[model samples]
Target: MSRVLVTGAASGLGEALSAAFEARGDEVLRTDVSYERGFETGASAPSSTSGGYRLDITSDDDWAAALAHVESTWGGLDVLVNNAGVAGGGRLDVATMDEWQWITEINLFGAVRGTRTFVPMFKRQRSGRIVNTASLAGLVHPAGMASYNASKAAVVALTETTGHELAAYGVTAHVVCPSYFRTSLMSSLRGADTALAEVMSKLVDESPVSADDIAAAVLEGLDRGDELIVPDQAARDAHALKQTDRATYDVVMRAQAVKLEEGAR
Candidate 1:
């Protein structure tokens, strides 16, 4: 069985993924910002054999500590799943610099840090898997979620690039582009201002997929050695749209923008 490390293991998709791996007899090291709570409530409860760590993905020091702990305890990691992220709401014009920075730091930079930090270790092993959690929003430019979309899109690009570079080492990289999975991501969506909360809420409610389904898709993709894992039917449809009709896709996204704004009001 593979030795796996999953970030954002406190709840939602991360927790589920950790459990899935553990159930298959793989050793899992789960990490999140809330160590005690996540361990007691999410990771440990589902699989007592899995280890837990308090990890702040935005901090390089924290990543170093976690990596060191894993190396000391497990010898080497076979899979690294960068599953931690946050969602932000608002048009690009209305988002504050701080807000954009905060989201990107976690959603984009967090994954980059993990990949950079872990690649050397994986190279030493000469075989490993890196799974980056992106979103359907990355493929289709949705309105009022510019920062979130951009961060996920960056993940897709990073995963593709890293996959190419790591091929010679037998280390495979996979990008998971999931449609709205039922997770705290929606609950955490930051508004440009308080007034935009209603619009964000509506958008989240319309999402068609669940975290469990996405987790299943992720496992399947890993098994199949797929480079891009579109987890849900809606996400697959969106990806196909981007490939088939660029102008029509733009028109649909513009209409979504109008709807989002009207919902906000």
Candidate 2:
């Protein structure tokens, strides 16, 4: 089995991913900012894993500690899953500078930090995988999600570039661009637009898919060596519509935009 490290493992997609990797007999080191916050805020932390540690992706020190832990505990690494992120969005002029910075720092820079820290180890081993969790918004770019969409889209680009740059060294990079599914990700949602937030919340709550379903598809995609994994039918359909029918795509997108405008009013 592989030796895997997952960030944001306390809840949501990260929790599901950690379980999925463990179910496949891989040794997983789960980390999350929540784990750190538990100590800082005096809240109850989640059940401890054998090698799990508190990691705040925004901190370089935390990233360094994680790498040290992996080396000391596993002796080698196989997969690095950069899955920690917050849910955030706002319409163009409404999004605050602080919100943009917050979303970008975690959603985009968190992955970047993790990948950078682990790349040296992977390069030395000459075999490793980087799995980044982006979102369908990264590709589809719907309305009222400027910050979130930009952050996720940057992740997509980072993964693609890493895949190309690391291929010769036997390293592969994969990005999961999943649509809204039942996940505690909404718990971390933040934005200046309350209306947009509610709309996103409804979409997430009403989705027919679950985190487990996405995790399973992610593993299957990894097994197949897929670089881009769009696991859900909804995401696939949306992306396909964008690619094959631009006019129809614009109509649907604009209609959603109109609804957001109405909601904000």
Candidate 3:
């Protein structure tokens, strides 16, 4: 069984992913910013065998500790899943510079730090995979989500670059861009735009797909060696339209923009 480390593992997509990996017989390390918050996995707390770490993805020291733990515990890592992220965004004019910086630091740079920390080890092993959770917004920039969109887009770009730069070493990178789905990610939503946050939360709550579904699709994408995995049908369709029919895509995006303007007024 392969050894996998997943960030943001206390709940939501991260929790689902950890369970999914465990179900498949792979050993998983479930980490989050606060282990005190506890995992949904029945256990009130993490045990030594749980391999859970309180990883603040933004901290260099935390990343170092995580790398050391992995090496000392598992001997080596096979997959590094950078799935921890927060939700926040607003129209370009409405989002503060601080908000942009805050979201980007975690959503984008968090993944960057994780990848940078493990890549040297991956190169030494010459066999590893990096899975980063981006969003459909990364590919199809919707209105009122500038901060989130840009951050996720950067993650997509980072994953792509890593794939190319590490191909010779047998290291692969995959970025998951799923549409809104049922997830606890909404809990971390932050922005000056409360109206937009409410709208985004509604979309997430109303989505028929669950985190488990996305996790399964992600696993399948990895199996197929797909670099860009748009797991949800809505995301797939939207991306396809963007690629094949710019006019229709523009109409759709513009209509959303118009609605946002109308709502604000």
Candidate 4:
């Protein structure tokens, strides 16, 4: 019966996560940019014991309004999932400045803002859990996904720091670094290279996981108070490779990037 707030609740991991939490009898407040017709899953934008609302994670005002609602309604918060993110893709040389800004604002700054806004309340209550959804791309550092990888990597750092800061207050932070899965996240992605997109799409389709698996892993991780939750085997292996051999890993990744590009040609 934890009071939970999940961003990007409209679909994919977020939607499935909301339903999962609600099914567990926990109070869930789902929020996103809009609650349109097709957003029925995350479209419950009105604040209730089991409903949601429109919350643009990139806006300070929107964050404040949502927190205000929580103050008046729930009176306190327990879990916050900074799960709202849009995909941005490109190599560092050709990537747009605006694209980097856009991606960071939502993927990184949005999480920072959420945690900043809620920290006071968490301190007051002296108990909270903040879960951030990063990606294997962050750890794997795959080429052509520079923007996405950098932003998600920053999230991991942010959450680790926040966890350290809030541990004294009984507030914990969890980071979920997951590999490809069946999710609506692909719908929000925008790419400049069709070849990269084709390769990623093929790899993702070949991935043996689903959004539900990720959600389930997050829940279990939260329950176990595990700080780092790598949901699937692919993500685990990626993190391990980087851990075991940094220089060799980098060389291999660069070589793979070359091969991927050549294959695309």
Model 1 earns a TM-score of 0.91
lDDT of 4 by residue, 1-265 (tens): 8888999998889988888898898888888887532223333333444455778888888888878877876799999999999877777665788888888989999999999999999999999999998888767788888899999999999999999999999999989899888777777777666677776777767767878888988888888889998988888887898999898889989997897678666
The candidates, ranked best first by lDDT, are 3, 2, 4, 1
Scored against the true structure, residue 158 in model 1 reaches a CA lDDT of: 96
155-203, model 1: which lDDT tens digit per residue? 9999999999999999999999887666776666665654456655665
Better of 1 and 3 by TM-score: 3
Off by over 4 Å in 3: 36-51
Alpha-carbon lDDT, every model: 0.82, 0.90, 0.90, 0.84
TM-score per model over all chains: 0.91, 0.95, 0.95, 0.92
- Over 133-194, each residue of candidate 2 has an lDDT whose tens digit, in order, gives 99998999999898999999999999999999999999999999999999999999887799
Candidate 4 to truth, TM: 0.92
Please report, as a residue range, the 10-residue window in candidate 4 with the lowest summed lDDT.
37-46
lDDT of 3 at 126: 99
TM-score of 3: 0.95
The worst-scoring run of ten residues by lDDT in candidate 3 lies at: 38-47
